[model samples]
Structure formats: structure tokens, C-alpha cells
Target: MDHLSTTHSCMEHLKSQNAKKSGIKKSGGKERPESSFVAFRAFLSSCDLFYIKHTCNFISRRVQKHSHLVHCHLDRTIGNNAWSDLFPRARSHYLIFEASDHRHIISTLDSKKKKSVRLFRYNRTLCDNLEITQLVKEIWNTSSACSVADKITRCRQAISTFSNEFYVNIRKLVQLKDSLDAALSASLPDDDSSLG
Candidate 1:
């Protein structure tokens, strides 16, 4: 009964508020004289107030969510025994989320090793280097392996070595760019830092 009465009273209050917002005030039961310009201005002002209120609410909600997320983390990672065997030294780590709405979770398979985990990739820039042909020819011709697969693997290894040796300066520049990007992210974040 109390709940029903409270809801009824709230509806009455809303109706009264709507009536007050109808622009022209009643005067002796005759339609009140209100200028079109004044009515339009009143409508615009109300709309502006509503827009500002909602916008402020949205921004505050986002800020509150971001601020409260510093200690609150609810992310999950599921794997099987096979996965565990493949990556015995796997670990989970959190990534900072400043510009994004959701925090990130990273899983590193080998977090302790300082060795390069970079996979072999054939860059378009490699074609421009004139020494690539000579290196390939030397690798293919000098390989003593009889089996085709063994020869291919030997050539791949040689090419990998050549790529590393040839792109040493490029590697240094990449390191420098990464450091600069890190410094920049300290002030403003991009997509996500937790991902590799």
C-alpha cells in the first residue's frame, strides 16, 4: 500500500511539472497570451538544460568507471594441459588503460628470457637491398644438404642470419622509436600497451 501511494504521488508530481512546462500560464480559463519567440526560447533553454545534464552524467560515469578500475580487475584466461606444456613459463600481466574504456590482459609465454622472440618475416624493404640476391645465391649454392627440406632449412637459416646482420641499424632505430613511443604513452595512451 505504501509503495503504491509513493508511486502515485511521484506520477502526480511529474504531471504537475509537465503542466508547468507547457509555456502559457492559465489566466481566468482563457488561453494565456505568450509570444511565439518567448515560447521558442523557453523550449530551447529546456532542451539545452536537458542536453547538458545528460552529457555531464555520461562524462561523470566514464570518469568514475576509469578511476574505480585502478584496483578492480575481472579478466579471465582459460587454457588446457597441452597449452601449459607448450609454455611452461607462461605468465599473466596487466596493461594500463588510459585512453581506452576496458583494461587489457597480456599472456607472455616466456617472460623471463631476454632473447628475441621475433619471428622470421620477409619485409618488402628486403627486395630493394641489392645484396639479397648474392646472399640467396651463396646460401642456395653453398648448402651441402642432399635432401630438399634440409637444403631449404639451411637456406632459411642463412637468410635469417643475413637479415639480422643487414638490418642491425634498422633494429637500433626501432628500439629508439619504441622508447620515444613509451615516453609519449606515459602522457597519453593509444590502443593498448599490454599487447605485444
Candidate 2:
């Protein structure tokens, strides 16, 4: 049988065991607190399950004051295999409670694998810079490619290279300015106003 089916069977077996001990005649009736606790404890003893903390600070229960903490538990094997090649990293998301007072938990496997999003950056200030205009003109005029697509591609590559270099230079200049500002501030007199 599958893992879920096995878990279900084990839970059922625990419930039955609890029921027998409690002398409960009916199976479909509301479960008693003792029976529920026994079953839950038995299930915990049988499997290596532990609770996962929720992302939010708010309690899962309907009442804000009362803290009813329930955790999302996974098999010990699953947790162990997460670091290995067999399984990927996983995370649990606690959904908002609507119909039920308790919040529902959903485990998402391979949570570390993220979809790459490419952002195209445009520098509007480049239009005003004469150096950038001259560089673009040089790149466009120097391309030997006969086809319009190839020429456009070459120009794009040249522009991208220029933009990357420009940004790096700008970043260094900003860093230098920040350092100078910090030094100036440090060297200043502690008395409220030295200039006045």
C-alpha cells in the first residue's frame, strides 16, 4: 500500500484501539477528548512527525488572545531525505482559516527551486549623455553584418556591454562619495555648530 494509505490505516488502528479502551460502542459518533488524545499520542509514537512553524506571527485560532498552536508534521524519512539527493527542500504554508477555526496547512516540496525572472533595465539618463550617444553611433556604424537582424543584435550587445560598464563605474563613484561623506562627518566638531 502507498504511504498515505498506510498512515490512514495506522491512524484508524489507533482510533479503534482508543475506542476499545474507552468502551465506545459507536464508530461514527463524536470522538471523546480522551480517545482523541490517545489516538493522537499513539500516532505520534508510531511515526517520526514534528510540527512546522507558521510564517505569520498571528495565532491560527479564531480568537486573537488564545494561542492554539498546531503544527504541520512530516515523516522522519521525508525530513532526513530533504538534505539528501532523494528529496528536495520543502516548506509549509499555513492558509487563512475560513470555515474552520483551525488554519489549514499545505506542504510544498522543492520550495528552494525558484523560477528565474529576467528584468530589462532602461537608463533614461543615457539619452542625455553625449558619450553614450557617440558610443551607440560608433557601434551601429562599425557593424559589418549585412542583414538588418544581425546588425541590430550586434548593436544590442554593444549597448548592453556599455550599460554594464557604465553602471559599474557609477556604483564605484557612489561608493567613493559615500566614504568621503562618512569621513567628513567623522572629522566634524561635536559642538552643535563650528561654522557659526
Candidate 3:
């Protein structure tokens, strides 16, 4: 399974686990917590195709013993499966607590295998344009075998390319307007444009 389904499996397990602990009921009848999180241990049976590592990203103030407070692991790391496959020697280290009560979890990965990602912002106005609409539709139907993720990536690229061109034009227009205003001001003797 991919990251989404893997994460969904883990989260669904946690949600049900929490509900049971908090005395909350849900649909789908009663599910045993152990059976719900089969993905975690089941990976081992699948010839170690995936792995689940329990790591603490932060601390939740719960479970008080005597005069001291004990915190249980609230956040779990399910993606360690890929990490082991990429860098077997690397391990997660919990750094010292900083401004927040949560400690940072640092793990090393093969940087060469990772691709540089830039943030993409979606604007509602971009969707209103005919070009963008047509672009999205064309990309969505371009390949019958394209997965949903692939289609989304293509649409984003198209929208980003179109928006970038518009942005450049806007910048050029602003610069041209500024230059004209500067030239007009210089042509006049002073702040007065009486044309005497």
C-alpha cells in the first residue's frame, strides 16, 4: 500500500483505540484495538516489506505518578518503513526540548533520492479562467491509465505555469508604469505641472 493508505490504516487504528480509552462509541460495531492495528505488526509477516517504529514527536501531559508526571508516546512514526529501505544505518534521535514541550525527531535519509519540492498555492480566481478550466480538463483526460495523483500533479503544473506567466506580466506592467511616472515627473520643472 502507498503512504496514504498506510497512514489511514494507522490513524484508523489510533482513532478507535482512543475512542475505546475515552469511552466513546462509533459505528461499524465494536472493533478490537489489537485487530485494528494489524498493519503495524503485519508488516513483519510480509517479509519485512514495511516497518513501524514508535517515536515520540512531543509529550502530552498525562499519567501522574507520585510527585512526578509521566508522558506516554502519543505520536507514532509509521513511515520508518521507507527509511529502513533507504538508509538502514540511520536512526531517529530525539533532540533536547526547546521552546515547546515537544522534542524534535530527527532521522537521516538519502538526500540524493529526494527531489526538491516547491510550495504551490491555489487561487480561487485561477479556477475561473477558461484556459485553466480547459487545461485541467485536458490534463485530467489526457491519459486513461493516469492515477489520481498523477492527474493532480499535471493539473498543478499547468496552473502554476499559467499563473507564473501572468505574474511576470503584472511585474512588467508595474515597472513600466513606474518608469512612465518617473519620466513625466522629470519632464516637469518641479512638482508643478502648469506647463508654463
Question: In lDDT terms, which candidate is top?
Answer: 3
In order, candidate lDDTs are: 0.44, 0.45, 0.48
What's the best-to-worst order under TM-score? 1, 2, 3
Clashes (N, CA, C under 3 Å) per candidate: 0, 0, 0
Write candidate 1's Cα lDDT for 1-25 as tens digits: 2243223321111112122333332
Who is ahead in TM-score, 2 or 3?
Answer: 2
TM-score of each: 0.35, 0.32, 0.30
Q: Which residue runs of candidate 1 sit more than 4 Å off their true CA positions?
A: 1-91, 96-103, 107-119, 177-196
Q: In terms of TM-score, which candidate is stronger, 1 or 3?
A: 1
Better of 1 and 2 by lDDT: 2
The digit string of per-residue lDDT tens for model 3 on 1-196 reads 4445444422212211332222122222233465554654554334323324334332321233454443433332334344455565444444444444334455444323456678888988776789889988888988669899888988898898888877687777666655543433231223343321
**Ten contiguous residues minimizing lDDT sum, candidate 3:** 19-28
Clashes of 2: 0
Off by over 4 Å in 2: 1-88, 91-119, 169-196
Model 3 off-target regions past 4 Å?
1-117, 167-170, 173-196
RMSD of each: 20.2, 16.0, 21.4
